[model samples]
Target: MDEEYDVIVLGTGLKECILSGLLSVDGLKVLHMDRNDYYGGESTSLNLVQLWKKFRGSDKPPPQLGSSRDYNVDMIPKFMMANGTLVRVLIHTDVTKYLSFKAVDGSYVFNKGKIHKVPATDMEALKSPLMGIFEKRRARKFFIFVQDYDESDPRTHDGMDLTRVTTRQLIVKYGLDDNTVDFIGHALALHRDDHYLDEPALDTVKRMKLYAESLARFQGGSPYIYPLYGLGELPQAFARLSAVYGGTYMLNKPECKVEFDEEGKVCGVTSEGETARCKKVVCDPSYLPNKVRKVGKVARAICIMSHPIPNTNDSHSVQVILPQKQLGRRSDMYLFCCSYAHCVAPKGKFIAFVSTEAETDQPETELKPGIDLLGPIDEIFFDVYDRYEPVNEPSLDNCFISTSYDPTTHFESTVIDVLNMYNMITGKVVDLSVDLSAASAAEE
Candidate 1:
C-alpha cells in the first residue's frame, strides 16, 4: 500500500478493466481497486440466488428455475458487433484469447407494427418484405451507393460529399419511404433517435457499412455476437489480461475515496485508511459523484422465458430494435434474448431483456411495448438506473471518469465511451486497424 504507481483504476467495470489491461500493456504500473468483491462492478452477472436476492430481496430461487449455479444473468446486458470497434479492440489488445463468442441469430426491427429482419445489403433489401417492389429497387440503389462508398476512391463518391450532406438528405435522394428509413437508421445504423438525420451522413454511412460487414462475418443471421456464458466474461477477461501484464487488483476494499493534493489534482486513493498513491485516477461516475451530471434514466425489464421471442424465427439469440417513432417515445426500445445455447440459462430456459431510455417513472409501463413481444415470461424483474456523464476535465484534475451504461442492447456506445476515455488517459487514439483474421482467432 505504500508504493506509488502510474495510474489507479477504481472500478472493475468493463471500461475500467479494459483500460487497466491496455495501460499495463503499455508499461504503466496500474493499481485497480473495487469496493465490491465481484469482478464486475455495475456490469456483474448474477446467479439464480443472487438474482433473487437483488430483485426479490431473498436468496431462494424457485425450484422450477433449476439450480442457482446454472444461471448467469447480466445486470447490464449488451451484445457485441461481429466486426465492430470493440472486436477490433479485443484483437488489438489480444484480450480475446481469454474469452469465447457465439454469433447472434437475428437482428430485427419493428416498423408498421410488425418486426422484420434488418436488410443491410442491397440483395437483402430486394428480398425484404418491408418495402414495395419499386421501393425495394430504390433501397437497393441506396445500399449499393453505401457499399461502394470509399473515402479514398473518387470513383465511389458519385458526386456526393457525405461529410457535408445530412443523413436525411442522403436518404431523400433514394426516395425511401418512412418505414424503410426507420429500419435503415435505427436498425442498421443503431442510432438512438432521429437526431442523426440532421447530422452529416459520413458517420451514418460508416455505421451501415460496419453492420453489413459484421453480418457477412458469420453469415449466420445477425451482425452481433455474445459470450457463451454472459457479458460477465468480458470484464473478467480484461482483468486477466491486466494481471498478465503485472497490474495489481484489490477487491472487497471498502471506502475507496479519491484523495486530491492541495492543488486539487489526483494524488492517491484511500481505502480502509491505507492510501495507495498514484498520479492519475480512473473511475466510474459513482466514484466521484460531484464530477458527473445526471443525463437520463434507463428503464429495463429482465425476463426468464421458456421460449424464444415471437416472430424471430426461433433464434437461440436475437436483437430486436423498436424505433422511437413506432413507440411514440423520445428514444428507441431494445429487446435482447439468449437461451441455453449461450449457457446463460438452464436447459429449456431463455433470458430476455427489454430496455429503453426512461420517459416516465414507471419502468414496467414504459417497457410494455417491448415486453409484449416476448409472448410469455416465466419470471420478470423491472429495474431503473440513472445515466450520468462526466462534468469535470481530466486535464485539470487528472481524474478520468467513465459514463454510466446506457440502455442500448449493443456495446457500440459503451465501447465509444471507453475509447474516448482511453485517448484522454494516454493522449493517443487506440489504433484498431488490425487484420480481420485476428478477430476470428480470438474464438480459438
Candidate 2:
C-alpha cells in the first residue's frame, strides 16, 4: 500500500482504464484502483439482477426477462466507429485480442418526421429518398467533392480552401437544401449541433471522409460497430492490457482520498490509512468532485423490447440519430439498438437506448420523440445524471481528471478526452497510425 509509482489512476472507467493501459504500455508504472469491485466504473454493464437493483432497488428481476446472466446492459451505451480514433487506440494497443466486434446493422437520421438511412457515399446520396432528384444530384456532387478531397492535393480542392470556408458556404455553393444540410451535418458528420455549419469546413469534411472510409471498411450499412457483448468489455480489455504490461489494479478499495503536498500538487492517494505515493493522479469526475464543475445533464431511457426498432429494416443492431433541427431541439438525440445477435440480450430480446442532453426537467417527456420510434417496449427504465468536467488545471495540481460521459451514442468525444489527457500526462501526442487491418477483430 505504500509503494510509489509514476501514476495512480483512481477509477476504472473507460477513460481511466485506457490511460492506465497506454501509460503502462509506454513503460510508466501505473496503479489503478476503483471504489467499486467492477471493471467499468460508471460505464459498467449490469446483468438483470444488478440492473434491477440499480433502478428498482430490488435484486429480483422478472422471470419473463430470462436468465439474469443473459442481460448485459451498458450504463453509458456508445458505438465505436470502424475507422475512428478509439479503434485506432485499441489496435495500437493490440487489445482487440481480448475482444470481438460486429458491424452495426444500420445508421439512420431523422428528417421531417421519419427516420431515413444515412447515405455514406456519392452513389448512396444519389439513391437516397431523403432528397428530391435535383437535391440528390446536388448532394451527390457534394459527396463526391468530400470523397475526392485530399488535403495534400490541391487539384481536388476546386480552388476553395476548406480551412477558411465555412461549411454553410460550401453547402450553399452546391445548392443543397436545408434538409440535405441537416443530414450531412448531423448524420454523416455526426455533429451534435449546427455550430459546425458556421465553423471551417475542413473539420466537417474530415468527419464525412472518416464516415465514408469506415463505411467502406466493413461494407456494412453503417460505419459503426459494437463488441459482441457490450461496451463494458472495453475497460476490462484495457485493464487486461495494462496488467500484461505490468500495471497493477485494485478493486473495492474504500475511501481513496487524494493527498496533496504543501506545494499544492498531488503526492499520493490514501486508502484505509495506508497511503500509496505517486507523482501524478488520474481519475474520473467522481473521484475528485471538487475539481470538476457540472456542465450539463444527460437524460436517457433504457428499453427492453420484443422487436427491433421499427423502420430500421429489422437490423439486429443499429444507430439512429435524430438531428436537432428535425425536433426543434438544441442538440441531437441518439438512439442505439442491439439484440441477441450481438450477444447483449437473450434470443428475441432487444436492448435500445434513447439519450440526449437534458433540456428540461422531465426526461421521459424529453426522450419521447425517440421512444415513439420503438414500436413497443416490454420494460423501460429512465435515468438522468449530471455531467461534469474538470475545472482545475492538471499542470498545476498534477491531477488529470476525466470529464463525465456525454449523451452521444458514439466514442468520438470520449476518445478525444482520453487522447487529450494522455497528452497532458505524457507531453506527447498519441500516435494512432498503427496498422490494425491485420487484426481479426479490427472490423468484424
Candidate 3:
C-alpha cells in the first residue's frame, strides 16, 4: 500500500488525535499511527474487569458501589463507545478504601466514609475538617479574589503573576496560620510533589485561581465532569474524534526509525515492516529531550486499588491526600480515584494511582513505595492506616498492579505541550475537556 497523504501524525495521544481531526476536517488526507497496539497511548484503558479477574478473582463486588447513579461505570463504556469514544481500563483495586484520619488530639475520623453534603463552595470546603479553620478562611478569601478576575482579557498578561504564586509563598505572604498553611501545602503535595510548594508562587496561585473559577462557573462541576469511565476515557474521546475525521490509528507497532530529510525536516516514519510517508510529523512522548539525548529517562507509575473509599466524605471524586513534610527524596506520587464510574471497577471499589518519576534503569523493586516529592509516607499514612484499614488484610485476590513509562517528557507537562503543538500545527486552539475557559476568559 504505497499511498501518500497531506500530513502524517506519528503518535496517537490526545494532541495527535486533535491535529489529525483538524487537518482532516480541512479536507487533507492524513495517516495516523502509534507504536502501541492500543489507542490513547498512556491514557489507554485496560479491561479492569478482566484485569481484576486475572489478578484478584472474578467474584468480587464491583469497585464503584457507593458512587452516584449518573457517574456509575456499569454502562459508561457502551454509552461512550456508541458516541465515538474509546476507553482503556487500568484495574488497580477491587474496592474503594478510605484512609482514616486522627486529629492532632487523637480523635479517629473516617476521611472517606460519611458524606459531608456541604455547600460546594470554597467556603464550605473550608468549614469541613478536610482542612484547618484558618486555612479555610484564607483559601476562601483567595478564591473570592480570583473569581473577580476575567481570564480571557487580552490584557490579562501571560506567564506567572501573583495569581500563580506557590501555595507556600501565598501562605507566607498572607501571614496565614501554620495549620492552614500545612493543610494547603499537604493538598498541593498530594496532587504534584511536596516540592511543588516550592514552585513559583505565581504559578500556584494561577492554578488555584483556575480551580476556584471553574468551581464558581459550574455548580457541582467537580463531580459533573469526571473521566466518564476510567481516566482512559479522556484519550478515548480524542481517538474517536480523530478516526471520524479520516485518520488511521495503529497500536503495538513501535516506530523503528524516523525518516528525516537532509534539511532536518521529518518526512515520514517506519515501524515493524511498514513505511508510511507524509508531509508533517509530530512526536510527543514521556522522556525529556535532554534526557533522551543522554541516558534517557522513563516514568514509572503504580495503580493501587483497595476496598472502601478511604478518608473522605465524597465518593464521587478522587480525594488527594498530601504528605506533611516538605523535604524528601522519592519518585512516586499518589492519586486516588474512586471508581464511581463502574467501568474500571465492580460496584463498591476504588482505584489509586501511585506514580513515581524514576530513571529507566531503575529496578522496579528499588523504586520507592510512592513519589519522593511528597515526603515521608510514614508521616502521612501511619495515622490514617492505623485508624482505617484502607487495604484489606492480606490483600484481596483480584488486585492488579501494572507499570507504565514514557521516554519523552513528564505526562502532565507533555500533555499540555502536545495540545499547544496541535494548536500550532492546525492553527486552532485545542479544547481541553476540563474547562480552561475561565482562565481564558480571565486573560481576555
Candidate 4:
C-alpha cells in the first residue's frame, strides 16, 4: 500500500464520500477510512428479516394464513446501532405497509378518501389535511413571497436563513386563524420539534418554504435518489467508485490523534495504532468537533412491518402526532411511511417508522408511552389498507425496531467546518458542496 497520498478523507459519511469521489476523479490520490467495519454513516439500510429472527424468532408459516407464495420474502432494511457503531438487520419491508391516517375523532378514512390530491397551489394544499388550517395559511403566504426565487438568486434562503424565523411570526404575519396557526405549529413541531419551540419564527418559515421549494423541484425535475438496494448501497457506491478512480478505502481504522506540523497544517493522522501521511486530510466522521468530547446526542426510531400489507389509504405521505398531556413533555413523536419508492419493501408488506427524541442517559422504558401500539393504530391502518383484511389475530412477525443517535452537529455546519478549514489553508472553495453554502459561512 502507498505510504502517502495527495488527500486523505477521515470519514465515510455522505460528505466524505462526495469529497473522496470527486478528488479521485480529479486525478488526486485519495484514501477514505471509517472506524466502523461497514460503510453508510447514518443512511445505511439493514437486513430486516435477519434482524427480526435474531431479536424475536425465526420466520414460520402462519396457520390458516394465506399461501406462503403470496407473502413477499426478502431481506429487510438494515439499521445502525443506537451508538452508531454496529449495523444490524431490521424487518424486511418498507414503512408504507403499516401507515394509516385518521381524523381527530379516531374515525378511519377509506383508501380512496385518505389523501385529497389537490392542485399544487398554496390554497389547495392548505385545504388538504396534509397540514392544519393555520399552517396552510402561513405556508400559502410564505410560498407567495418566495414563489419566484430560483436556486441562482443571491438571496435564496437555506436552513440557516430559516433558523431565524418562528412559526408564531409566520401565522401572525399571514393573519392566519388560531386553528390554522395551531396546525402549522404542530406540523413544524413534528418535523423539527426538537428545535422548533425555541427557533425564531422567521427562520422557521424560511426553512419550511425552502423545503417546499425543494420538494416542488424534485416533483417537477429529477428526484433526489436514495440507494435502491439499501442505504448501505450509497457508501458502498462511493467506496467502489473511489477505488475505480484510484482512491483507497480503509475500514475499521479509527483516527486516534490528528497530527499537525508547526505551521498548523494537518500533515498526518494516526489510526488503529498505525499512522498515515497525507498532504490534505478531510474529516467526514459524524460529530466532528462534537465527537472529540462524548458520544453525542441521538434519537430512537422503531420501524414496524406488518404482514399482508393492510389496505389503508391516507392522502398524506407522513403523519405527525403530538403527544397528549398524559404523554409527558419532551416526548416528541412522529410517524412516516415510505411512499416515494416501492423497491424499499416487498410487494405485500409495507413499512412505517415511529420515532421519538430521547436523551442518551434515559432507558427505552422511559419512552414507552410514545411507543404504545394500540391507540389509533387500528383506525390509521384501516384508513390506508381498507381493501385487505387484517389477519383476524394479526401477528406482527419479523418486525424491526432500533434507536439511532444523531450527532449534535448539524449537517450544514459540518460541511462548513470542513470547507472553511480547507479554504483557510488552500485559499479556495475546494469542494462543490462547500460552494453551495452561503457566502457568510463559506468565506473564511
lDDT of each: 0.92, 0.93, 0.40, 0.40
Off by over 4 Å in 3: 48-122, 130-140, 149-170, 182-202, 216-224, 250-256, 271-274, 284-306, 314-317, 323-332, 358-414, 423-444
In the range 191-269, model 2's lDDT, one tens digit per residue, is: 9998898999999999999999988888889898899889889999999999999999999999899999998999999
Give the runs in model 4 whose Cα sits over 4 Å from its true position.
Answer: 25-27, 41-43, 49-121, 129-167, 177-179, 182-191, 194-202, 217-225, 252-266, 270-274, 284-291, 307-328, 339-341, 360-370, 373-444
Q: Give all candidate RMSDs, comma-separated.
A: 1.0, 0.8, 13.0, 13.7
Worst 10 residues of 3 by lDDT: 381-390
Let me know the TM-score candidate 3 reaches against the reference structure: 0.59
The true-versus-predicted C-alpha distance at residue 69 of model 2, in Å, is 0.3
On lDDT, the candidate that comes out on top is: 2
* Model 4 agreement with the true structure over 1-444: per-residue lDDT tens digits: 338877777666654564565567667888777776767654445444433443346654333333333322112122211111111000111111122111110111111213122223465556666566666766676556545434455465433243455655444555766434433443322233434545565544444443343334324211112223334454465566678888888888754455667765666768766777777666533323422333224334344344312322331123334332224445444333442233444443334444444443553564344334322321111110001111211011110011122321112323334344444324555423221112112011
Candidate 3 lDDT tens digits, 291-388: 12222233333332434334333343443333323214343233334453444554544543333334334534323433332232211111000001
Displacement of the residue 27 alpha carbon in candidate 4, Å:
4.6
Looking at candidate 4, what is the lDDT of residue 73?
A: 18
| Per-residue lDDT of 264 in model 2 | 94
Better TM-score candidate (2, 3) = 2
Model 4, global lDDT = 0.40
lDDT of 1 by residue, 1-444 (tens): 788999999989988998898899889999999999998899999999999999999998889999898899999999999998889889899987878888899999998788888999999999999999999999999999999899999889888888899999998888988988999999999999999999999999999999999999988799998888898999999999999999999999998999999989999999888998999999999899999999999999999999999899999899999999998889999999998899999999999999999998899888999999999789999999999999998999999999999998999999999899989999989899988777674331
